[model samples]
Target: MAVGRNGRFSGLLVVAGLLAGSWTGFGQEKKSEKVVVAGTPAAAPVPAAPADSVTDGSVTVGGQVIAYRAVAGTLTVGATATQDATIGFDGKTLPDAQVNSPDKDKPEDAPATARIFYTAYFKKDAAAEHRPVTFLYNGGPGSATMWLHMGSFGPKRVAIPDAEHQEGAPYAIVSNESSLLDVTDLVFIDAPGTGFSRIYGKDKEKAFWGTDQDAHAFERFIRRFLSKYDRWNSPKYLFGESYGTPRSAVLSADLQNVDLNGIILLSQILSFDNSVDGPKWNPGVDQAYALALPTYAATAFYHHKLPTQPAALEPFLAEVEQWALGEYMTALLQGSELPEAKRQEIATKLHGYTGLPVAYLLRANLRVAGGVFSKQLQTDEDTTTGRLDSRFKGPDLDPLSGDAEYDPQSQAISSAYTAAINDYMRKQLKYGEQQTYLPGAYSDPSFSWDLRHQAPGGPSATEQEGGTNVMPDLADTMKANPRMKVMLAGGYYDLATPYFEGKFEMHHLQIPQKLQSNISYHYYEAGHMVYVNEAVLKQFHADVAAFIKSTESGK
Candidate 1:
């Protein structure tokens, strides 16, 4: 099931909205402590995190710059290369998490942690001999990589049922059939202050918090990982959901500076402020209109099934985009004084476009919250309101007119997955630690959502800059490594990072049209985690397997 992503908790948006640090999965918190360095590094001063210095493209030496020192070392798989699975993040070295019973008699005091420890899952039975290795993470800006890690794709998945709100046993997670692992090696990196990752005092904190700083940190992390893994030449891909989607977009260019292949965005959110577009006085008022359009149509298609074939949605959306960007944009700009003629016209079109009544659009003045349509679209006469997520509706005692009965979608999305993450951490992970996974309020006020808007024309000299667009750099990588193939994935109903906005960047980025065929993007019907739909999962895995096998693009 997908999250009721639109019915955002405006307050929680502020937390992730500000830090831009490590927002993957649900959320993450890391303990930040600096380490003293000793010994010398075998390499030269890295102007940036050089990709070839360490194995796996990552390093954990104590000192920085030319004074490179080994604070951490490698622990190659002890197995007979029989398709490695388990991994451990023990400081000073990496280790295999092989265990006999798994349930230890008494778990030792958790080791003193350093370096936000993370693990990777390289699926066995290699589906592709020369498969592309994908790096996946979720979006919390404060989240740990665990969400997408164990919960979704990782080798050892979180224990949860496939459907929402399953009873008997808290959750049961298994190998994700939709996981790209069948064709790719997946690495989950914990961002600073979340998971085992942490801040090294205030100095390090400053660098990992803001937009630019966060990008640089991720850039450095990727470089170090490539070096540590010794896969600098391998075909590399990155995937992220929600906030992680924007992180992947920014990192696409950031990693290109150091050299990376291509990028994939899942439920993307390109700009913090733009996601909620509107006049300065009432932010997001305009964007709210656009965001509500797609899902409304999706619901309409779901309920009415007008055109018969689901594929028929494309023509309708093509028209919705035209109206939203054109007339809808124009009307929202017109405050109370919409000439009677234009009002009637817009109201009628709104009714036809979104299966909602023209009276509602007229009363709302073309500005309606996503929640309103989600419930109103399917509300019954006896039941005045339905759940916020039209996806989930149940009969209720209390009846309401304006507000939704409840946030069924949010609760459903949280039910199975949240329980699974906790189980996966304990059982499969063998981390004996027993702690409940806290799925933050769908709209917790504590989460950061407030940040200064980007300048009209991107960043200026006076303003700070970190992770912005570096699509051109990725283009350069393709130019250098013509052998590599790449893919990009987008979600159609994603209000956070509208697929249309992402496609616009290629126009802004300077790229030779001939080389463009190497990177191809495929869209899905689901909201963010397209894999949630078993049908989509079947197709997504097949496509990823084909791409990793070097058959994609006729290459």
Candidate 2:
């Protein structure tokens, strides 16, 4: 899915956008609360509450019972040091900053601040310096980390169909046998304005709602977390999904004071130009189409839509990947100059791999956009193939439309995740009893995102003029910390950020060739959210655990 100028998915939340109507389920009272606007009299300061709620929990992973202490809380951060120094970790204003002033009465006079929420699991009795800690989050740019919290490596997970629509409520929320608690302490964070996190003061949106600003907010949060928990010496790792992958890339570079042990990326898209969702808008960027072709073939093969079903998926995709980068890319580059015979030949090949009609392929000029492909792939059955996971299908909202209006995968499983996190946080973790847990911030009309990014060395004039790309930030981090390992994981059925696109970006990183060996790749037979499949979840858990253990030894 494309991350629009607003930093939200046009079709889905790079993670998965919540359905608009689901907002009512969170609570109606919060809807009445207003954002304190600049130039207005500041509202009476709310009474200070406990900074966090503490709970104890245990989960059985790989037949071993693990006990943990869960802390659900919010950490206040400011746009700058002056703003941050105003509030203490206890949510109380500092003594030096406490003063009655005429100008302070105005909301704009105070600096912008955000109370970033998080749920952290620390293994009981583990040595802080010896045990590894991994920070996990999902990406919408506007999305909360609830998906990773409720559906992936969390101590518990909401049980839904592996690749089908989940039936209504009474959904099973169960202990996750695949939980990563066995190998690392996990911290799942809600981005500012999502879940229990809240931003306030003057121009709060501009302060925290952009590519560069968001990474800085996370950097501050991580630094504050390490200090609060006194785990500064622990092996630290970052695990981010979808848009979070790009956030990790920038954040890894920003946190230069600390040398991170590793970064784990799922459903990655480091370069916005490589996304298939809106490549049509940027002419001459043919890499997106070529990189996405392998995923198209995988999806077609899964649905039995391909002209010839390959006996093995891995080998078939290998063949398609080779052709996509070679013959197919060459044809697309030729554009208007390509001979009719060559264009026809390419369309024929696309038909065999994508299962779309030859005429439709020809009409599209052999460069099918992600949404159009999702709509056309299963149009014969009057269904829309999923953009997040092509293994999922839902009735088309508009069969006659040029592209899919909604993602079938998002629609199929969003409710289960939303409900699971709400219930678990309140009833189990004992947090957010009075506040609304926002799955996304897009519901707020004031929510806006700045796409401009400052790379490692400095702000690039070229980046300011084009789509945001954090490949330099990641490459710089890897080169500076050569021992810092990176793992890229994705699903073959993921069209949102095609699995092959991750490989393409990693291969092209600006780092030295010798440093390339520090990166690893893993692919699943599932979709964007690979852990949605129980079978794949098992392998996902093992792979991640092994990676952490291998690096944690500090050899």
Candidate 3:
């Protein structure tokens, strides 16, 4: 999930809208000519055929030259099987087109369709069955996969400051020595209505902009991709970051016919209730605060804000984690019934760990929210700590305000990413020459997210009144596919989805104790976008490569 310009958590909450006739040569028409027919309704527009631009490139990874074929393309997907049957891999309408197109004025008309965009890199002359293919995407629910494509595991990466705000460019786009191509083929996909992906047809927003609906779209896209590329026998894996983590859980469970080899989650948040963003709204649920404390302590330790400086970070964090889940949580649960002396004692400890004033902690009732912490952590210097990466700081937009106004980390490197993707897609990849790339889909005011979800073996269309939790989905997937492996990676400095929250959710999954062995965890010293740190990125590549090699068939 991404922190928006307004400092509100976006990614999951933000939705998207149709670009409404954007591309010229594509299936979307600029304007539909009105045709009046007697006793007949307008036929649903046929989706454009799949468009692809193939290019060959080579990158040196792990000190070996890897020649790869890159395909930048779009594949159309329907809202349902009936609509899907109308289109084929060759982009021709099937004989059953009339059966799929419903009356335009009918309430039961099909929802909007999407032409999902993706850039895939295949190892030259590799056997499909032997090569593991990993589908990678960034989560903004509304965000494009540009971050992962341009900043992380792709063949080329955008170079920016690790923890400082990058100044205006001529930003360098360099060969990624750590690209995952050495171990697995990579496909980076942009969500519908983001990047070159577009959605159109009836009730577009409601059709593709919800939890279940979005998962379904991705499911269709993956299936279609496998069929088109003849990779059904390949050992497949899903690599999702941020909001994409929950998407992976749901999608993994839904794709029961396909036995995935593994799932790699970066900066995960399977349970939204564990979010530290604005836990104050939910009052009695104190886990968010407790889960976030370790990250707060890590940030304080990094910034040298701790009252008594700890000699080492990891050991200090271990102590903080123990206190947070033990004494700190017990004190919070007491809530107004606790004696003033105990409250003072807890507040003092919080200050020592977080470097916030004891008076501030007392004023906050010891339940400081993530935004408030970001605002108050560096208040003495009039700086606002980044919610995504606390290591990055910026001048406070509102010094007197209780919450941070914007994310400094996002502002710091967004330009370099945007510039790099635009240049690279056009110049290197030879796609999107005539279209504009949308980094995210928050610009449209018509966008609205649907939080209702139907978990496996649960009632259908249940609104998550207490916030959406997909821990059950992951657990059910593991139970169904007992051999499937899972990898969890996160940054200690990420307050957006604290590293501890991922651990907490994974520990609480309803799977058997034996299945717990299928899961592995890795932590980095960086923030939400851990690859921003070159050192962490190198280690991340190694861990992921090793995980894939261990899990893939015939490895």
Candidate 4:
């Protein structure tokens, strides 16, 4: 479970990489769509949902100053109160088991055990339930919602000197005119154990830390949030990055009983079958290499490393995609049985596309893994391209190592996000949480996470033989909710969850042929966190705004 600062893999280098809108007309289309642990508390009663702390704010976007209300609050889930699992600086337990679940479907005596913390901004004058509401979160399995909260979708964003440089403090906070606030309401949720959220007990941590359980908790939280705010009638959307993409997919299935308008998957890693650095001929290697080739080409093109640079990006990408799926895939499927001359030809062609040396490609059996490419691509310059964003380069700490030492892309903007989130929560939003805001990186102590999901038998069954792969979950969700539309956004340089992998997953989602068109793909010139690139950020906003508009129009 490699997790990066914003949307990186659990152990992988940080790569990084929002919005909302409309309804009534789309509602006519008739359709649409789509955590944790804690020990069993004593006989203590469950608490009601926490009162929301509201603050008024205004931001001028697209020449309009939209007045809005920002509500910072805790929404309780489960059957008992949230306990402070924090130790007294020495790992001592501080249990506060008074929080309770408001399970309307269960008995009044039903228990509640966890509390979710969220910040919501809504246009004050807009129609309450008519405006679209997009719930946003980042994936670290351990990450908080801060990245999307302050970096992209929120009204205020952190200003960095440049996305490729270390944004040292004191960083500036500026208005994110590109924010989706103008088109939709936003609610940024800090996943349990991240940000101000907490579960009642240590034992409960395992429950919230897993795949299916995590989605269940979020589903409950969204239902409760809607009930509390009287937003059940609003057009709902889910926006997730990195690991959050899988969570979004599973959540869509969990909420299938409810109508969901759309889903936004940014920098998605829906399938974990792909490898970054490993033996190249494993069971999943063919699929992994095939999916990665186009991205390798994209990165090589970005750096002008390809033998013959194409004049334009899209047509060049089409060429790579065609090769990756055609001859490249056939060669990989042949494996060791292939003739040396054939392997040599494939290796030479791979070199032409990936900018990796033909000698190395031949040695690698014509498979150039991600980290290998990241380190070897710029060998002459003694630099390592970031696994998160190959466009960002750093010193080659261990030039001999197979992987990039650390993600320069993660380091580049970490300071700005950390400082901005801390300031925005306390100063502007008037949030009073005293706990540290965890930025869901793998380095965090609490980030020790579980990737297991309940066996196919149901939520209470044994583990599935193979580990987590949520592609089926997303496909099933789409199948069950045909009206729900999806926008899969990818950054050409995002090695962590390469754009080509997303395309592969979408193509193989195993849904109906008609349903296949339900998911659309968009590419950015940036990396995992495409919004970090200013131009891409604006384009992201525009693209997503259009997506939301389209979904509402049922087109």
Task: Judging by TM-score against the true structure, name the best candidate.
Answer: 2
- Candidate 1 matches the true fold with a TM-score of 0.66
The ten-residue window of minimal lDDT in model 4 covers: 18-27
Model 3 misplaced stretches (Cα beyond 4 Å) = 1-50, 89-92, 96-111
Tens-digit lDDT string for candidate 4 (11-62): 2222111001111010011112223258844433333444567899888877
Better of 1 and 2 by lDDT: 2
lDDT of model 4, residue 73: 82
What tens-digit string does per-residue lDDT give for candidate 2 at 218-330?
A: 98889889989898999999999988999999999989778999999999998888888777767888889999999999999999999889999999999999999999999
- The clash number for model 1 is 63
Of the candidates numbered 3 and 4, which has the greater TM-score value? Answer: 3
* Deviation from native of the Cα of residue 255 in model 1, angstroms: 2.4
Give the Cα-based TM-score of candidate 2 against the true structure.
0.92
lDDT tens digits by residue: candidate 1, 1-555: 112334322111222322243232211232233354687342221111111111122111112111111111222211112112232322222355453322223222222122343456543444433445677766555555555665455543445333243455545555455555545576776655555354332133344554445555566566556666666666677766666755665566556544444455555445433342222323434654664466566556655723333467777777777777788778777767679889889888777766667787778776665446544665554332222223344443245656443444344445455556556545444442433233332222223322222322355523634323334444555566565555666556543344655554443335567766766777777544565555665676666666666642235
Ranking by TM-score: 2, 3, 4, 1
lDDT of 3 by residue, 282-330 (tens): 6788899999999999999999999999999999999999998999999
Angstrom error at residue 387, model 1: 10
